[model samples]
Every structure is written in structure tokens, then in C-alpha cells.
Target: MAKPRRGVQFQHRGSNHHNGRRPSISESDSVSEPGSPTGAAMNGKLETSKEEDESPPQSEYEKKKQNFITRAIWTLVMMAAFFTAMFSGHLYIIAIITGIQVMSFKEVIAIANVPSRAKNLRFTRSLNWYFLGTTMYFLYGESVIYYFKHIVLVDKVLLPFATHHRFISFMLYVIGFVFFVGSLQKGHYRFQFTQFAWTHMALYLIVVQAHFVMNNIFEGMIWFFLPASLVITNDIFAYICGIAFGRTQLIKLSPKKTVEGFVGAWVCTIFFGFAMTNVLMRYKYFICPVNDLGANIFTGLECTPNPVFIPQAYHIPSIVTDIPLPGSLHIPSIVHVAPMQFHILVFATFASLIAPFGGFFASGLKRTFKVKDFGESIPGHGGITDRMDCQFIMGFFAFMYYQSFIAVYKANVGDVIQTAIQGLDHEEMVEVVKGLSKHLVNQGVVQETVLECWTGVVGNRR
Candidate 1:
């Protein structure tokens, strides 16, 4: 610029200057040197890019296969746990059901609890759990009183509670209601009331239905096992059929469901239920009611078999024989089957046709909440409530069905013992014993000498 140098050209290589030419070998080496910070950062980025290029993404089929394998493993584990609890004893089964109820309640409550709604109310969470506890106490107490009336009524300490169980339950509920009302804040009425309603819905759906399930178990393990098995079998077959030949949609509530699956499952469930009943009827442990509360599967129990389990023979009807045969020959048939088999057919029919509505109800609930599952408690199975939806309806139906149609009313030793001791005072009890002894003597069931000795002993005690 000073003199417009003709043959000589001037260049600057400052930190901010650019020559507009490719760098020399020495300059390039300096920029890529391992000791330089810029070189180290570039090297890191290059290695990251290389890794990304080397690793391939998983295909959709592979992902689905992996998920299925995971689900299968977890299902096998759950079944193992379930059968283990079943073989343990009735008490263990009750405990498992109770635990499931609590977990289900927790999941449902969590869904209902919106953070925006729960921000200010202090007692909302506490009140929910309190309601759960009170409801469980009431329902469980009713079951214990009814099933173990003899033992509970005889104990002086527990007598008052047993006698006024319903009143106690009501009073407990009233106390909780008062507490909830008192704790309501000035601006939080709407939120608190919504939570209140939510809590009660959970109680009805999870707890009340679970009470019926407990009753089914005490009535007989068969009542609980058969219905539950039928529902599970139906679910399995429905899924299998749906995948194999499903084309036409069954319902909008569950798009994955197909008409083919629904019909196929019903047919398979009926046959499975009939076959399962035949096998279970052979075991007295499954068919017998829990007479001794203290007895377990290991100690074993003894009871007269329900008449339904006993096989009986019947002749084929004449109407069937009236059918014209090709060769003018008639074949007489005698069928030998248990009465309970026919009863099982009824139960299986209901389980297949009606119980699945419970699943539809759950699906609607999930869609309402914008959730794919109730919770992740069971890996691939969702929450306990999710798995037990149809089971709850099935259990309630089984309990009602047994009480109305199948339950026997024979008086057992516990009934007699309760009537004798609980209905009489001390002196009346002694008199009743003396009268029984005298009656036995007269009937030649005991000797007069032995009766006199027993009477003398009773007199001395008095």
C-alpha cells in the first residue's frame, strides 16, 4: 500500500487473519496434534461419530420379540408365586388377596391425585388412607364374624365388638367424615371433595369387591379357583385367537380385540372350565368349606364331601330315543357324571360372556386417564387392579352363585357347640350337660353308673 510493491507480495498470518489458501502440512500437523485442546475435542467428536456409524438400530420385530420374552418370564414367576400361595393354606391366600387390595388401592389413588389439586390440602392424603383402613376393618370384621361366629362370640373381650360390628363401622366412618369436613380449607373445598369421591370409588371398586373374593375362598377353594381360572383361560385364548385370525374389529373401546377372538375364547373357556372342574372335584381339600379356621393344607382337614362331587348315574331321556334311526335300532345310554359338572357349565358361560365387560370398563378408565396401563407394578401385566378386573366380577358372581344355588346348610359341630355354650348361662350349661347324660343313659348309650358318677362330679363342682 505504501509503494504498491510490484514483484514482491506481502502476507499476514495473525490469529484472526485468513490466507484464503489450504493449510501446509506443518500447519495441519500442528492443528491435529494430540497435545492441543482443539485436537482433543475434534478427536472425541470423530470417535462419537464412528460409534454411531458402527452400531445398527433394532428392528420392530426384534423389539417385540424381546418384550414378549420379558413378559413371559415375569408371567411364569407370577404363576409360581400364585400356586405357592394357594398350596400354602387358606390364610395365606387371604393374606395375598389383602396385599393385592392394598396395592390396587394405592395405584388407583395415585391416579386420582392430581398435583395441582393436592397442593394446598394437608389432610387429603391422610384422610384417603384413613378411609381405606376404616373400610377394610369394617368389611374384614363382617367376614370374620360371620365365618368364625362361634369363636368370636364366645370370647368376652371381643363379644361387644362382634355384637355391634356394623354400628362400630358406621361410627368409625362418621368420625372420618367429621375429620374431613373440619380439615377442609376455605378455598380448597372443590379439590378436597373430588379427592373424597375418588377415595370412595376406589374403596368400592377395589375393597368391596375384594371382600366378596374372601367370602368365595372361605366358602370353598373351588369357588375361588374355578372362576378365576376360567377368566384367565378366556383371556389367554382370546389373545391367541386374536393374533392368529383377527381381522374384523370387535369394539372401539379396545381396537385390538376382534370378533373371531371373542367367539373363540368363549368356546375354549367352556371346555376348559368343564375339564378343570372334573379334576378339582376329585380333591376334597378344594371342595370342602373351611370348617376349622386354624386348619391348613399341611395339617389337612376332614369334612363330609359335598353331594355335587359324588358321581351318580342317569338314563338317557325317551325323547332322545324317539329319534328315528337309520336301521330301526335304538341305543340306550347311561351317563355317569357329577352334578357339579353341570353347575360348572353355568359358571363357565358367565365367565366367558359377562366377565369380560370388567375388562372393557378398565380400558375405558385407562383411556380417560390417557394411560396405557394402570401402573407398572407388574412389568408387562400392569397393576394388580388391571389384572384382577374381570376376576373381581367373576369372584362376586361366584360368591352369589354359591350362596344362592350350591351352598349346603347342614349343621356342623361348631354350630352345635356355639348354640349350646353361647345360648346358656353357667348353671343352664351344667343342667344341659346333666340332661344330655341322663338321656344317653336312657338310650343305652351310657351306663347309669357312669351317669351317676358324672352327676356326682357336677354336684361337687357346684
Candidate 2:
């Protein structure tokens, strides 16, 4: 009564100030004391969130360590996937190669597409992919016709494709070429032509080379697997050797490459190749040609091993053998080694000494474009092309070497069937079939009645 203190009067009326009524318990709790349980819990949550949001910056060494771990993990993952495809079947391996070819081509062309995009030339990109599809149709068609003629020629659906694949491929390419010419703008002659040449270059460097690698797979799994493994082994050992003992730089294009590492990797690769060949030679799944696309490691294949896989005795030259021995001692006069072991030395040498130049070439290419990598298709690995640069050259060499030195020049059933189907008329084919049936009967490979029935059928048709 004597007019309460101003603060006490305000506090008494504060609850009813909003609507002339006392405030609820929830409203009171909203302005609770700092020492209350709810206030302490709220403060604790804020601190927890702050701690979670703030992470200390990593040092250079820590960043590098993390990168290395990521790289190693991806490496293992790629290897596992590769082996799985290899063991699954030829078709699976072919699918993998095709995927790689497309991805690598995309990465290579994308570098040039940046300028085309800026210039608003959308057709430039379309032309690149058009050319790729055209090239693939030609190359894959050739492989199918050459390797599986028995099936392709007999199937009505596939016969036309097999016989005229090249023509069809050429027509497709010409369409793309005409479209490109029509799409040319007035002020962009030099840039358009440059892109044109770049597209062809990418086709040759990536698609053409990959086609030969695919041929190697059809020739035999070893031709594809061995060379690829050699390249990969050399790359791994080169890095290890470089880190262990490296001083002199091997090439200006690639500063990290060292002479010591190069030489060391050569030695290590040779040993690995020798050992790997020995193991692979024992499995027909690795040595046999792919007669069945569906065949797998478990199903297995049957073929006489290539002569190179067989052990042979090589007489050592006295002068060469005695040089490394003591004056009183002599090395063995003859050493037993598989011929493939000797060939593998050459492969290992190339994989170590020459194949790396492919990587250096890619390095030079990246320098020309002022880029760090071809693409980000693979984490830690950079791109398919980065991993495949050495592989393309190595595979090309393997294909050439196999064709030149290893492949036995002999006619197989597919070759005969292809020649017969293409070279003879329909009537002539019937006659040849009858003649072949009669010949088989004479040889006791077929019953004489079979030839009579075949002759009767042809006679009725005529």
C-alpha cells in the first residue's frame, strides 16, 4: 500500500501483462535459471555441436598419408575386379575392355570439348562419339566375323552384318563426316579442323590400339593377361624401387622417374614374369583360345599347350657361361627353361624400359593441355587412360609379337567356313556339302546312307 517498489510492481503484473491471466508452467520454464537441469542440458548440447563442427586442419604429411591410403585401397579394388572378370569368361573380359575403351575415349575427347562448348559448337561433341561408334562397329564386327564365322555365317540375322560390316561402318562414318562439314561455322575453320584431327588421333591412340588388345584376348587369354600383368608389375616395382633408392632422373617429361628405379624394376619384373608364366601355363583356361564366349575358369578348356610353354634344354655358350664363374669352376652346360621364360624376359624388358614411355607421352600430353589429369573417372587413379596408357602400348607389342613370332600359320575350321560361305554361290554350297558328305562316307567318318539322303535333298531342290 504505499506504492510498492517499481520492480516488485512490474514483476507482479508481468504474468498477466499479455492477456490479464497468470502464465503457465511451460512459459515459466522458458526463462528458467542458468543453474536449472534444463539449462545445463541445453549448454552441454551446444558444446557438443561446436566440438563436432570444429576439426583441426591436417598437416601436409597427414594429407599425403591419407591420399596414399586411398590410392592403395582403390588399387586393391581394381585388381579384384579385374581378376574376377578375367576368371569369369571371355565375354566378361571383352565387356570390361569395351567399357574401358569407351571411358578412356570420353576422357580424351572431353579435353577438346571444353573449347567446342565455349564456342557453342554442339555438333563437335556429337561427331566425336559418332566416330567412336563407327570405329567400334567396324573393329568388333571384324573380330566376330573372323573368330566366330561358324556361328555368324549360319545365322540369317547375323550373315548380312558379317559380310557387309566394313561397308556399313564406312557409310556410318561418312554420314558423321558430312554432318560435321555442314555444321562448320564461318570464323571457326582452324578450330574445327583441329578438333577433327584431335578426334581421329584419339580414335587411333585409344580405340585402334584397344582393338588389337581385344584381338589378343581371342587369340588366347595369355596374350592379353601376360602383357597387361607385366606392365602393371613394372609400374608397381618402379615406384617401390624409386622410393627405396633413386637419384638420377630418367626423363625430363617425368621428373619422378629415376634410372636406378628403372633398372631395378626391370630385374624385378623379369623375375615376376617368369614366375607368373610358369603358373599360368599350367592352366588351360589361360593358354587356350576362346572357342566359347561362355566358357569360364571352372568350366575349363582343352588345348595342346603352345610349344613355348614346354620346357626345353638350352646349351649355354662356354665363353658367356664361364665369365661369371670362378677360374676353377664352370656353369652348367645346358639349362632347362621354358621358351616362354625367355620371351617373358623380352616382355618384361619392354614393360620396364619402353612401356613407361607411354606414360611419359601421356605426361607430355597433359603438359600440352595444362591439366593435372585426363579425367576423374577413377578416384585416386585419375582416369582410365592414366592406368591404360602403358597397357595400350604393351598390348600392341604383345599382339605384334604373338602374330610375328608365336602364332602358328594354319587354317582352322572358322577360316574354311568363312571362305566357303563367301566364295561359293548357294548352289555351289549345296554341291560342296554333298561332296563333303561323300568324302566323309569314304573316310568312314559318316555312313554312306547320309550322303545319299543329302544328295536326294539337293536333287529335289534343284
Candidate 3:
């Protein structure tokens, strides 16, 4: 039951590489080191396993199923205290985000296919990483709540995304999962999980930090989809394009991916911008208002201010209104509205572009580690990291962009408001007394006093 020291890599590169496909030192091309029984057996297994490991079969079914299950589990975990946040319902969303952190941490363990170990040192290390991730995730949510209370800022940093919440929630739990796997007390399994969990977490965290900064551009739960949909879409389309018309391979690391596929994915992504934008818009307006953005209260039409109603120089009840004296306040301030659709496009487009890089990064990792697909635990998809790879990467990206482009975008849309008084004619200044008398006859939302003020300063001046 012992594994060979020279474990075969999933993908076979040519002769000089350690990928296990090369001919051995024996006189015969097919044979191994001379008289080395162990080496010969290793050679035979390497030959057979190479033929068997063709990407583990990237399955669309598995992908969609995982997505559904992940979303469902997240929804359930947050239901407990979502309503408990009371008026702070956005806290519920943060709770859900926390759940994502936990699940994602679990996903890393699943991806690396870290075989369970019984050694105490290994078990403890794995548990530590898990706890660290969770602590970070938990702190992230707290940090969000802290800043949500303030007026939006200049430098964006989401402490929740940068915290150890992921470790605390799931990394710590990984040890318990393997300890209960079986009664195999003879050997160790904890160390493998530790290495696996730590490796996966290390890679996924690049994404975690990215999300913490760009949260403004990514809005609502749609922030989740920014990376999700884009990366997944890129994967599917790129594969299809590569299979259909690829003529050139982009790199030796990911030989199957082609230049044709890259172009096709890019072309398709532009369209995704439109579809994804609309999707986020709907989600923001209805499904998930993570920022309390769309929640506007209507004061009713009963006492709505008339657009044309002007105030007089000495209006009624002016003393009680506590109106700022002289140059302190600007009256009749105007509100300028920004187009929501534009913001959506910016978010979706940027997500579509940057999210796919996570997959590329994974491809690079597979090449560097000299492994294929990270692991074979997930069936047809290699491992959890393989499946959730883009989410991890894009999560960081989406969070950062959402904060920058969208939040900063909001800032760029002017806020200072100026209200102006109007005059009636060229002769108005000479008629303040007459204007006051003229104001006495005005009616409706426009008071007689306002009319008197307006006559001196309305139509005549620009």
C-alpha cells in the first residue's frame, strides 16, 4: 500500500521534466533503473496513471450543482440571526458574507485533497490555519459595521475581508473532520490536511484582500456573482472555443487552453458586461441591498414641497425654523441623481475582465507544484479549490472594485447644492416696497411675501 517516492504528475510534459513520462536509466527505452525493482514498479505505475489523469473531467453538472449547494448552505446559515440584527439588516448580509468566508475556507481543504493525518503536530497546525482564517473573516464583518456608520471614505479597506474569520470558521474544523474519518489508528492523516489547507488558504487569500478594497464597485450580493458568473463563464466559453477552433497553445503550463479560447472568452465577456450589469441592477434593487442603497422612504404627498414655491425675505415662522443666518445656508437646494445603470456596467465589466485571472493563477500553481487540478476529491473537477478558484480570486477583486469604482464614482457625482431666489422684471430693485405690496396679493404654495421678494429678484436677473 506504500506510494512511490517519485509520484507521477497528472500532466505529462516531455523527457527532461520530473513529470514521470520520461524513459528511465535502463538500457531499454521502456524499462527503469537497472535491477531496481522499486524503480521499475514506479515507472510502470507512472505510465498508466498518466494516461488516466486527463484533467479529471471538467463537468458542467458538477459545477452547477456545487454552485447551487453552496448558495443554499449559505442562505440557511445566515437565517438564524439575520433578523436578529433588528434595524441593522445589512448586518444580516455581513453575516452571510461571513458564511461565505467559512465555506470558502472549507473549500480550500477540500481542494488540496489533504489526506487526513493522525500526528499531533499536523493536526494542530491545520486547526490553527482554520482558526486564523475564521478570526479574519469575523473581524472583517465587524470592520464593515464600524465604517458603515461613518460617511463613506477616501481610502477603502474592508477589515472583514482581510481578517482571520475564514480560519476560525472552517480551518479549525478541518482537523475534527479527518479525526472522525475512520478508526485507522495505525498511521497519520492530519499532516496532509494541514499542508493542503494551508496551501489552499494561502492562494485563496490573494482574492480575500483584493475584495476588501474594491467593495464599492461591487454592490449587493451581486458582488458574489461578479466573480462567480464571470469566472465560470470564462471557463466554459474558453474551453468550448479551445476545443472548437484553437490552433495555438498559450503556455506549456495549461496546454489545453488556446489562444482562440482566450479571444473567444474576451469577446463573450464584453456581452457578459451587459447581461451581468442588468442582473446586478435587479439584485441590488430587489434581492440584496447590502449597502441599504435602495431603501428610500416616502414621506407621502400630503405636505410635499411645491417645485415653484418661493420663500419671502421675511417669511412666516422663519424664527422657529432656525434658518441659518445670512450666508450660512443655501435655500432651495437641488438634488442631482446619478444613473444606476452606468454604475452597474462599470462593475460587471471590470468583474468580467479580472475574475478569470484566478483560473489562470490556478493553472500556474498546478504547473509550479507539478500537480494536476490540485486534487481529485471533487470528481470531474479535481478539488474544491479547482471549483471555487475563481470565486476566491474574484471575491477579492470584486470587493476592491466595488469600493473603488462605485464608491469613488458616487463621490465624483457632485454633492454641494445651491438654491437661488428669482426676480420678476428689470425694474424690480426700484420696487421693493411695491413688491412687498404686490406679494400681499399672491396665493397658493407661493405666499404673498414670497411673491414680493421674487418681484425684486426673479425674472430680471439670470
Top TM-score: which candidate number? 2
The C-alpha stretches of model 2 lying farther than 4 A from their native spots are 1-55, 115-119, 317-335
Q: What order do you get sorting by TM-score, best first?
A: 2, 1, 3
For each candidate, how many residue pairs have backbone atoms clashing (under 3 Å)?
0, 0, 57
lDDT of 3 by residue, 34-88 (tens): 3477657767787788878854885999989887787567545434444343223
Model 3, C-alpha of 26: deviation from truth (Å): 53
- Tell me the spans in candidate 1 whose CA falls farther than 4 Å from its real position: 1-49, 53-58, 293-299, 322-331, 413-430, 437-462
- Identify the leading candidate in terms of lDDT: 2
Alpha-carbon TM-score of each model against the true structure: 0.84, 0.87, 0.43
Which portions of model 3 show Cα errors greater than 4 Å? 1-100, 103-123, 126-130, 147-219, 279-354, 367-371, 374-379, 408-462
Q: Ranking by lDDT, best first?
A: 2, 1, 3
- What is the TM-score (0 to 1) of candidate 1? 0.84
For model 1, residues 1-462, the per-residue Cα lDDT tens digits are: 487766655334444225655566645664659678766776787689889999889989998898788889999998999898887789888999999899999988888688776766777888989999999999999988878887887798988898789999999999999999899888777878888999999999889998999999898888888999999999999999999989999889999999999989999998998899989987777888888656666766677888888989988888886777888597567789888989988898888889999999989988888988888888767888889989888898998888888888878655765687657788887888888889999999989998899888988987
Model 3 TM-score is 0.43
Please report how far candidate 2 places residue 13 from its true position, in Å.
Answer: 33
Pairs that collide in candidate 1 are none
lDDT string, candidate 2, 1-462, tens digits: 587566555554675336655656744564465478875775677579878889677899998998889889999999999999999999999999999999999999877666734358767777888899999999999988888888898899999988888899999999999998998888777788988999999999999999999999998899999999999899989999999999999999999999999999999999999899999999999988888888999998888777888899999998877777657786888999888888988899999989999999999999999888999888887989999999999999999998898887778887888989889998888878888898899999989999888888878877
